[model samples]
Each structure stands twice: as C-alpha cells, then as structure tokens.
Target: MKLAFPALSVALAALAGAHALRIESSEVAPPADIRGEHQELERVWSVFSAEPLEKLHLAVPGPVFVRYDSSLRPVVTPEAAPTRGSAAGSQDDDESVEVSAGSAAGAVKEAGSLGSEVKEAGSLGSDAKEAGSLDEAAQEAGSFEAGSFESDLLANVTSHSRRLRAHKKTQDDDKEDDESDAPEVLVARVVVTGNSSELLNMLELLALKKSSNNGLRFHLQNADATAEGFLLTQVQLAEQHVLRHLTTSLSSVVDVAPRVLVTNSSETKVKLAVQGASGLLVNEPEAITLRDLDVEISGSGFVQLNVSSVQLDGKLNVNLAGSGAIALHTPSINASEIKSSISGAGALVVEAENLTATEIVTAVYGVGVGSLRATTRGAAHKQKITIAGAGNVYAGSVVANRTKVEIWGSGEAYVQVKEKLDVSTAFSGNVFYVGDAPEDVRTSGYFFWRTPVQPAAEDKYETHAAIASPAVYPEHVSVQTKQARHSVDPIVKKISVGAQSVVLSSHLAAVAHGPNALLVFGCVAFGLVAVGMFAQSFQQRRARRHYRPLV
Candidate 1:
C-alpha cells in the first residue's frame, strides 16, 4: 500500500509538469499595431516574467509621456536573440567578401588608366577653346561693321535666360516630387510608469541597443499577461545624465502634434531647461534654472505660457513671425537689474504686480507691444524704457521713483512716475503720463499728452488684444486652472488587464496525449518501484542486525 501511494504521487507530478509546458507554448505574443494617440498604461501586472530589464529606449516617431510611480514592481523579459541559421549565413557572407578582394584590385587598376586618358582629353579641349575665341573675335568685328551687333547680342542673351529658367523649373519640380514620395514614419505614443530606479535602468537599456537604422522597436511597460503596455519602439541617448533638459516640438514631416507636461511631485527642488513647445505647461518649482527661452510662432502658431515666481538670472528670448500670439503670465518677479529687448510683431506681458527691482531697462523694436504692471517701493528704483517701432509700452500702473523714456518711432509709453521723469520723443512717438511733466522733457517732432487727473482704476493700462486670436488651447492649461477654481481634483482611472487564456487545474489532458506521455508515465512508475525495493531490503538487514546483536 505504501509503494502504491508513492507511485501515484510521482505520476501526478509528471502530469502537472507536462500541463504547464502546454500552457506556456500556447499563449500568443503581444501585437505590434499600436497607434500614435495617447494611451495610459495599466497600473499593475498580475503574472509577470522574472526577467530584469535595466533600461528601455522608445524610438517611436511621436510624443512620449514619462511619469514617476512608486506602486509598480520591476518585471521584464529579455529580448530573444536571432537563430543559428542567420548567424551562419553572416559568416558565409564574410567569406564571399574576402573572395572578391582580387577582382576589386583589378578594377582599381583599370580606373587609374581611365583617369590618365581623361587628363589628355582635357588638354585637347583647352587648345580648341583658344581657336574658338579667335574665330569669335573675327565674327564680332564683322558684326560691328554691319551695324546690327547690339540687336544680335540682346537676342542671344534672351534665349540663354529662357533656357536657364526652363532648366531651373524642371529641377524644382523633381525636388518636390522626391520629397512627396518619401515615406512617413508612424508616430507612436509611449507611456513609461516607474520610479526613479527603474527609470535609470531604462536609460541603460537604451544605451546598449543604440543604432542608426530605425528597424528595431523597444518598449518599457510592466510585463502583463495580455501585454497591453508595449505599443511602439523607443530611441537612445548618448549617455546618462539628470533628466533636466527637454524639448517638445512638432515634426515638419510627421503629422503627430507635440505636447509636454512636467510636474514635480517630490519636495526636492528641481531645475528645468525647456525648449518651449506650443502646448507646454510647467508647475511652479522652488528653484528653476531656465536659459535661452526661445519660441518661434508662424502661421497659426500661437503659444500660451504661465510661469510663476521668476528670478531673472538667465536670458529670455521671444521671437514672433506671421502674426503669431504669445501671452506670458508671471505673477511675481524679483530682479536686481532687468534688460528686455522686444522685436517683430511679438507681444509681451509681465504681470509683475509684486515686482522688486533696482533698475529696469527695456528696448522695443518693430511693432512689438509690452505691458508692465509693477510696483517699485525704493527711491533708487529706476526704469529706462525705449520704444522704436509702432509698438506701445503700457506701464501706467508701474509706480517707479525715477523713469527715463525714449521713443523714436510712432511708439507710445504710458508711465506713472513718483519724483523725476525724463522723456524723449521723436517723429510721432509720444509719452502719456499722469502728474505734471518734469523739466527734463525733450520732444523733436511730436507732442506729449499729460493727463491732469489721475487715471481711473479700470483705465490704468490698456487690455491685451493677442489673447483673443485663435483660441484653440492646450488641455493642461485649461484643466489646471478650471480644477483650481472649482476646488475639484481630477479623477485617475485604475485599469487591470485580465488574462486571456483559460485556467485549467486538471492534468488529464496532458496525460491522455500519445506515446510520449505514456513513456514519461512508465519511467516515473519504474523509478518508484526501484526506490520501494531498496527500502524493503534495508528493513530486512536492520531486523537481522537487531536479533544477532542481542545474542
């Protein structure tokens, strides 16, 4: 009875092993047809592979979202290598290249002989050009004597220009057609959800699999049973560094638009260097290091920017082309010295309602408009504001101690001065201020408009007009503000991907298979019988040892 129980257990264990092999062999690999539109990743992985992936590079031709989450565990699968047949084929190719080396050397010698012949031909052509010049001189003398030289010269010039234009037109058309025929790489949206340690590992993986050819696809998602996270491939960076500098821009060729969001969840201070994409929204960080803030606006190119608590230590450059609008909102600004140069059809709004600065220097060029709503408390606080284009500087709400204003174009400056005000106006440029005009006023072709009474609260500064143009805005800009007003938080959906296969506990299906299954069962039975016989012989020896020892 004891032997029978042992045999039964061994048979059952073999059947269970076969059943697991069937389950693993039957599941399908993940699909590759992931779209460019944004999709959120599932938070958890139910049955994950134990393969540890260090890093991931996503090279999909679309926007990618990378966020930090502490709840997820690290689960990855190692990439499968190519088969032995492909490796053998590569070796054969190397041998064939070595065999062709002798033939390639012979071709090189023939090319050298051809180059010597071409040099001889070039010398003969130069001699023929000299003879042709002598004939042309004789022809020119004859035409001068015939008194129709000017008319003939004009006709030749006209014909030559027509031929050049036709050739240029053909070349332009060919260039356009070549550009049109080029393939458009599909933009893929990839979201990576992991903590800082896993994120660093992903960076390492991208470094290993870097290549010029865009053939391979890499994904960074928790390994789920259904494999819903992997949709597109990733790109590689040269080296690992702190995730500080980031650029978000729309591709001229790819149809997918660019959108970026950077939010600091930890209490630690973070620095950001942003290449201002149109729809960029950044939350307020404690200490920020921003340099060369450049935005190019063309066509319907409009950008809405809101950054708070700025300490001006770096350069801020804003350029506008084709009537594109930019509304920059800064709530508080602290600067030791401020210098601003605005040109083109750009508009700038510095909402420095609580601005503390010792010196503010501003120069406006082109039809650029600027509005500064600042309050300077100290007596040493001074402003040097200059306008050269048809632009306007509406600083009527700026209460400065001493102000210097210069206008060269049809520009205007509205100021609120405390003690001394210096104004210089040329052409139609004018300075409109409340309070008596100080003695240091110079006007060359225009007159100053000084209001007798202080302006009303509503009429302190002119309202901006660029904000109303093409109001289709970014989601982050709208969502953040709306939620703040209503005191309502946004809801996040937690999705768990379910397993696609049936869970089978019974091993009968594995054991009922053909000859291989029966053979495995027979082996298990034989092993159990051998172990039982060994145990029976050991018991008989022990019984004899106990009786003989007593005698």
Candidate 2:
C-alpha cells in the first residue's frame, strides 16, 4: 500500500510539472482590420521556448491598454515543426526556405488538392492574382460619376493602397517560403483548471515579436517589476481612430525611457509618468485631448514630452511634479483651452498661436519656470489668464480680443496684452506690463513698473541695454569714519589674521579627531566679508574721478 501511494504521488507530481500558467486570448475587437477599419492587440502569452531575449519590442497598431494582473491563463499547445517533405510545390525543393518564428516572413499555406498542394507562391497563380487585383483597382479608379470625382478618387486610392499591401504580403511570404522551417509555433486560447502553470522557454524567441490581429502587447507583473521595461516600434493607425488610454510609467531607477512614435492619430492622448531619469518624445497628433496628465517624479527624472494638436473637442489638463521639464505645442485653433499646474522644480514651456482659453489657471508651487509664447492677431472669445505662483511666468504676446490678467505671489508675470485689460497684482509679485496698460489695473504692494519703462511693439523689449560708465560706486566707499583715518593696514591685517587663525584652528581640530569642526567657519566667513568690503573700497577709490577743487 505504501509503494502504491508513492508511485501515485510521483505520477501526480509529473502531471503538475507538465502544466503551469496557460496563455489565452480574450474577445478583444482588434483595431481596424486588414479588410476592416481597425487594428488592435487582443492577446497575451507566456510562450514555451528555452532561448534568452536580446531585445523586447512590441508594436501594437491601435490603442492598447497595457497592465499587469494575475489569473486567467489562456491555455495553448505548440505544434511540431513541419518537415521539408511536406512541401507540395512542384518547384525545385532547393529553393525552399525554411520559414519559422525566427524569420521575418510567414504565411498560412493552403492546400489546393488532397494529393498535391499549391505551395509555389512564385508561380503563375500568384502573378494572376496580382494582375487581377491591379485590374480591379484600375477599374475602380475609372468607374465614378463626374460630380463625385474627388470622393471616387479617394476611394480608388484607398483600394489601390490595400491591394498594394496585399501584394507586398504575398511577396514577403515567397521570400522565406523555403527557408529551413523552425519549430512550428501554435497556441489557442483554452480553458484551464487549477492555479499552477508552467512557462515555455521563449525568452529571446518572444523578444521583438510582431503580434498579428492583436498588434503587439506585453505586460509586466509584480514578478517582472525588477525586470527592465520594453520599447515599442512602428504601430501605424488610420484616421478617425486615436491611440487611447496609453499610459506609460517609468521607474525612477531606470536611465532610459521607452521610445514610442505616435503620429497622425486623430485624437491621441498620452500620459507618461517618469519616476526617475528618463526622457520621452511625442512628435505630433491630429487632435489631442489630454486629460489629467500627472507626471510625478521623485528623483532627477527629466521628461521631455512634446504634444501638438490641430483640433480639440476636449480640454488639455496637465499636472507636473518632480525635477524635470515638460513642453507642449498647443493648437493654433481658438476653440481649445489648456489648464496646467506645476509643483516641485519642473520647467514647462508652451508654444501656441491662439491661446483663447475660457478660464486659464496656472500655478507653480516650487521654483520652476512656466513660459508661454502666443502669436495670434485676434480671438473671438474673451480670454482670461489667472496666474498665481512663486515661480517665474514669462507669457509672450498676450494679444487677444479682451485679455484679463490676474497675478499674485513673489513670482513675476511678464505679459503683453491687447484690447481691454483687467489686471490685478498682489503679495509683492511683479506684473511687467508691455503695450498699453488698462486703466483699471488694480495693484497692492506689487510693483507694476518694476522693470524699465521703455517698451517696444507687441509688448517686447527689442533694444539692447547700454553699458554704464565707471565712477558709479564712490558715494558709499568714499564716506569713511574718522576712526579709520589712522591707516588701512591695521584693519586689513586684523581681518586677515583673524581669518587665518580660525582656519588654522579648524584644521587642527579636524586633525585632533573631531567630527566636522564647523566652529571656525563663521569667523572665516566674517573675515571674508570684511576683506571683500575693503577690496571694493579700494576699487572704488581707483575708479572715482578726481575733481580738482577751484582754489
């Protein structure tokens, strides 16, 4: 009975060892299809393979939500490699390339007959298909009404593009149809029971993989938190579709940011949280509606994010906190508005042609710089800019229909406003106004003419400042007390002797096994200040013009 139990236990353990976490595919509607209008990522996998990953690159051709979670392992079974004898083509077998997962080319081979299959992709049938597709596109290009020429032309162009893509896919398949076929990779989503699962040795094999229909997606769980993040290459999407809910959070310990290229998507909104030192670059978007983008970094994590919008149906709200920089190129259109806030020492730069916001509120808690460059002739609505911060805000060319600027704090709001202006400054903050100032600019304790009065067109100071002549500092230094009339040598020697003695005593204490002797530092500092005053006095005495008294 004992022997039987041990045998049974061994068998069960073997069975458990054979199965681990299973990979599955959910019912995700992929982005625009090849024949449809979307391309999306709809699957995840922990494949089987014993190779190491050199690089990890996933390119999803649509808006993809990436996260890490447990449970729901989709079961999959890998297929055996197909033999060379399985080739059904009549062509010389020497030309057959064994296409495999490692190869960049692959296609599903369809059998034409039971005894023999059509595998000669370079044969006359493929040529006929290509010729037929071209003929159809050409026919589509011509069959259109005279009045609907532009619409028909667009349709024909899209048709031709699809055909060309299909043809290219065919050609790519032919290039690797005969390569030494590696092991066949096959996996289907299946229901599994129990919590235990096994992972395949597909580390390097899965790296830089291009997932079809699902585009390309990879998730990192708690088990993979220590592992390095991945990069995404080309994932192209069509118009009317936008890359949505794309959130990337980088570790503060990581030195490199994930490189992503998103362009021409109708409404692309990206939120990137860089915890450490990393940089991200977002080139252009057709119409971006960024909402509550919070980039909070603790360490010296520098993030460079550039977003451009041509149209907007939503507001742009960005909240930044950390030690880095974030800049934006807002839309030139007047319908959009932006709301931004900054904390911790992070720099923000905005370049826009028309910044006609309904209620623009910008605040900086820490010592960061917020700058805005606006260049527009006119705006329809009354633009209101409310700025409050302890940091500097340099807003250039606040030219609009009716501008209202309100500011407070120790920060400076350098602005140039046009039309009717309603200005308010408080808490000793400066409102350096250019162009014509409104009559009702309420001020308290804050300085309006804090800067020089000379103003230029468009509220910019264009002229260069002239250098001041010498002999400008004699009033303070020339007025010496009668007690000091004895000589400059005694006081100079006293200050130098005190400074040297303190420094020597501090060094001796440090040598005598003291823990950071900072006692003598104050004396040295005072002596240095006195020496600086004496030096300045000497320079002023030399620089002062000697006026001969009329005898």
All-Cα superposition RMSD per candidate? 36.3, 26.9
Off by over 4 Å in 2: 1-242, 251-273, 285-308, 330-335, 353-358, 375-389, 401-408, 444-551
Report lDDT (CA) for all predictions: 0.39, 0.38
Instruction: For residues 75-122, write the lDDT of model 2, one tens digit per residue.
Output: 434443344556434345534655453222222212121112222334
The numbered model that scores best in TM-score is: 2
Q: What is the lDDT of residue 510 in candidate 2?
A: 24
lDDT of 2: 0.38
